[model samples]
Target: MSTTQSDRLRGLLEPLVDAKGLDLEDIELSRAGRRRMLRIVVDSDEGLDLDLCAELSREISDKLDETDVMGEDEYQLEVSSPGADRPLKEHRHYVRAVGRLVKFQLAEGGDLVARIVDVDDEGLDLEVPGVKGRKPTARRIAFTEIAKARVEIEFNRKDKKEEEA
Candidate 1:
């Protein structure tokens, strides 16, 4: 999609998302078979649910139908939250992943899998799990050192409180 079109869509939809207590994370316009697809990814600190997505979809469809921005083109609108494994790009993404395990690809050429204990402007405070019956150790990683990061799914992970108890 053209930058101009994308900008226009963001400008139009951002306020709507914000008013509903969510952040508009991404907007994509792509081709799906013979029709165009407009995918809107939104999120909040409180998280998202199917009912919320449905509500936002209706609001977005109404806005698009009444506006001239889409120019009467046939397109399908999809409103969704970012998937669990989506890359952590922005500072807010890292903040939201606290208490969850993440896999990081270091710019210095190595990988680290750890749980985020805290986050700040400079970097992250991670709890790296130790092997061979060792205790988990605390570590820090600067933002500049990370090439990529994404949350890792844990099927049988226990909450910190549960472990402590």
Candidate 2:
């Protein structure tokens, strides 16, 4: 999307999202075969639910219908949360991913898989899991060192509560 269009869309839709207590993570307007597709990714510190997304979709759709920003074209408006696999681009994204396992692609070279323990404006404090019964190690990674990163999904990991039970 062009910068003007993207900025216009953010300007138009951000307030609506803010009013509903959600952060506007991203907006993408693209072609989907015959029709245009508008994907709005929203998030909150408290996370999101399906019901909230459905409501936001309705509100955004109404706002688009009232404006000429989309030029009256029939486009599909999709409102949803960012998926776990989505790359962490913003500082807020990293903050939100604290306590979650993340796989990082280092700007210098190789990859690192660690759990985010803390975050600061400069970088992250990560707990690198142990190998061969050794204890986990603490490491700090500057934002500049992260070429790319995403939260890693752990299906079999047990939570503290589950472990206690």
**TM-scores of the models, in the order given:** 0.92, 0.91
lDDT of 2 by residue, 26-127 (tens): 999999887999999999988899999999999998998888999966799899999877799999999999888999999999999999999999999999
Task: List candidate 1 segments past 4 Å from native.
Answer: 1-3, 159-165
Q: Which ten residues in a row have the lowest lDDT in candidate 1?
A: 1-10
lDDT of 1 by residue, 9-35 (tens): 999999899999999999999987878
Q: Assess the local accuracy of residue 37 in candidate 2 as a C-alpha lDDT between 0 and 100.
A: 94
lDDT of each: 0.94, 0.93
lDDT of 1: 0.94
**Which ranges of candidate 2 are over 4 A from the true structure?**
1-3, 159-165
Structure candidate 1, residue pairs in collision:
none
Per-prediction tally of clashes: 0, 0
**RMSD (Å) of each candidate, 1 decimal:** 2.2, 2.3
